[model samples]
Target: MGLLRLGAAGVVLGLASMPTFGQRASAVQLPTYSYFTVGTSVSVPDRGGAWLDGVDRAGSGVQSFGSARLLGGTRAFGTGRSAAGVGITATIHDFEALEAGLVDRRVRSTNAAPAGNDAWTARLDEARVSRAGRGVPSVAAINAELGLAEQAADQEAAGWLQRGRQAEEAGKPNVAKIYYGMAARRATGSQRREILARIAGLQPSPEAGQDAKTSETRR
Candidate 1:
């Protein structure tokens, strides 16, 4: 009878522990941010010729996306690439050091998200020129070469357009007009015209129509 009693106590204890075990497992499974360090790695092939003193490989570019953690930690993920030749090369870098770098980083400080407009503009221009430098290549090849970078630029423009539309919808005509003008400058042709029309329709007056002309001038 005592043994049975002990067995019953053991069963109760095991059942009591189950919730704690589950809670611990749940904590472990929770998503959290991490920091990382990224660097470039290059591979060169020896062609053994005048143009090929060493392996002719392109310099690496750094690109990554990451999030912040609750416990003053950051989680970052990165992918890098460099291609000078015909083959597509890619690298994924993971590290803890990135979190260390952003340990005390603020979310929206003026220093944190400070205007990257100039940088984006320069990058877009570079992509355009780089495409042109390819010497009259087919659109497919040009798109393949410049698409990712150019698309990033367009995405920024699209984001501006969305914000402008939101502002216009909120009846903030002046701010909407400014943002729409900016978006038109960033986008091209149909996209520009579409945003202009939306802005014009929002204000619905000679002044709003004038906004479209302003957008055209900026473009």
Candidate 2:
């Protein structure tokens, strides 16, 4: 991946370098307000094709705030319909990093539940061992990982839209509205319109209906 620059709006903008098999790139800084995030994107061209894109973010303290697979693009290298294929994957994690403190040396657990304390400690030990295999963890390093995770998650518009649909089907309109709003923020064209319409449907008021009509007119 190329060097990432921060825009005036604090968005991380960068181009990913073409990737080869068994290749790894360093993490790039991502924009965040309250915490830190970092990300890496790779495209590996192999038998058919494979790609991995991920971002990580730190929580308020020692937990994972969230982690997501933001984007994946692949192309097949064969002939006819069977010759080529393309696929994409996107994911998001909210309230992530519950075990982040266990992995990072800088974070010390304080308010954990008593019942799971022992299990948590064991997990922390495992994390410590894993970290040792890589290297000592530092605040800067952890923040970079989180930034990457956040960046990856931020790119997952479809994931958010799906979540909205799931919440709506579950009869949780309020929750669905939140997810739809997130999806609409990143969606475009018909997809965005569909998400916005779902959101409007959740609001039960004549004014909301009028507002929707006005929005449609403007669009």
Candidate 3:
């Protein structure tokens, strides 16, 4: 699946905590509530192509980023097993190719700039979801009950860079400088270099006179 998605809350407590294979003393396997998982397999065709493939049991959430080679449209098949304990499972997918397309409506509406009013927000939301939903599994069940969503670690870093751009465009050099510094840490090599260049341009250089004075003082 491409960038498998996650849905809301699900518990994945360890089976060890429960009665073992031999002890027949009355013990219950804690009822696990399932959440929605978004996945992509080659099997989904046409409209279903936008859907994901996977089963999420109660109280369990999934979050991962990874790539899946489509076997055939609407015919690909794969398997995943639930762990015996309480935790989330994730698989990494290549997000670079998909970045231009996916956008969570909820995220955009909740966090986009004001200039991108509700109308603009809706447009951007649609664009992102359309891209992200591709090959994503259905997590409605998980989200409706639990409330988990698949998230990316680098997502926050991208946000910071965006904010920095906004600050820079608004003529807030000091604020932009701080943001650029942050972006340099989170960004890739090329992006980091660009951010550093921007920051260097905005900063004032030390005066030669001050340098000489400092040297004399030290002597």
Candidate 4:
């Protein structure tokens, strides 16, 4: 669900042609595959009370980033009335709030980075399982399968961080931030500190003393 928030910005860049709904007929003569992906982020705030000094807060807030995708293929059989397909899904999660706590010299949050991948196969027994029999294969079942794939992908923190680095180098800081946030969920010790530093560096800083410059120039 978090990954689904990526919206139009989540488009997969330079992807190869994959099978579309109308291509099933032609797919019988060849292999057919397709893919879908999502990426997004969310914020989590701490409800704990603040310290006496407002400068140092008692609670730490977190920013979570997530990315997920599904790659699937279908094989038609017996005049294309029935088909079997397999899908692999992967997900990544990075928690920036945890990193913030580390940098603040306070262990206020306990969250981890997660990444994972999984695979599932489905068979279409008939062109139409039923006209009103709750649809073919069941939506709930499909969702369950995809959920498993997401879990697997979410367990691979290092992989997601590497992807974040790649995105950053490719001039996609927004995408890189998402990956880094997910990687931060699993980072520890010095590695965690390093990720926090990277996240901080990605943020834009305001121009220094712009108001004073304008005032002096006007005078």
Model 1 spans > 4 angstroms off: 1-141, 204-219
How high is the lDDT of residue 91 in model 4?
Answer: 41
Q: How displaced is residue 125 in candidate 3, in Å?
A: 47
Question: Model 3, range 1-219, lDDT digits (tens) per residue?
Answer: 333322211122223323333233332344444444332222111112222233333233333222223211122233344632122233334354357345565567655544645787777766765756466556887575443222342455567678878976776655666666665656665666787788788743233223223311110
Q: Per-residue lDDT of 10-104 in model 2, one digit per residue for the tens? A: 34322231232223433344443332222333221111222222323333322221122323333222221112222334444434343554556
What TM-score would candidate 1 get against the native? 0.29
TM-score of each: 0.29, 0.24, 0.23, 0.24
Query: Whose lDDT is greatest here?
Result: 1
Tens-place lDDT per residue, model 4, 1-219, is: 667666434564313323332234432244434332222222222222211111111222332222223343333433323333222233433345557557666422212222233222112223233255665778899899987766655566668779979977876665677778777766665766787788778742222123112221110
Which of the two, 1 or 2, has more TM-score?
1
lDDT of 1 at 188: 74
* Clash count (model 4, backbone only): 18
Ranking by TM-score: 1, 4, 2, 3
Residue 156, candidate 3: Cα error in Å is 2.9
Task: Return model 1's CA RMSD, one decimal.
Answer: 30.4
Q: Which candidate's TM-score is highest?
A: 1
Candidates' lDDT values, in order?
0.52, 0.50, 0.47, 0.47
lDDT (10s digit) by residue, model 1, range 59-109: 333332222231222233333333221222433232333563566464233
In candidate 1, position 20 carries an lDDT of 42
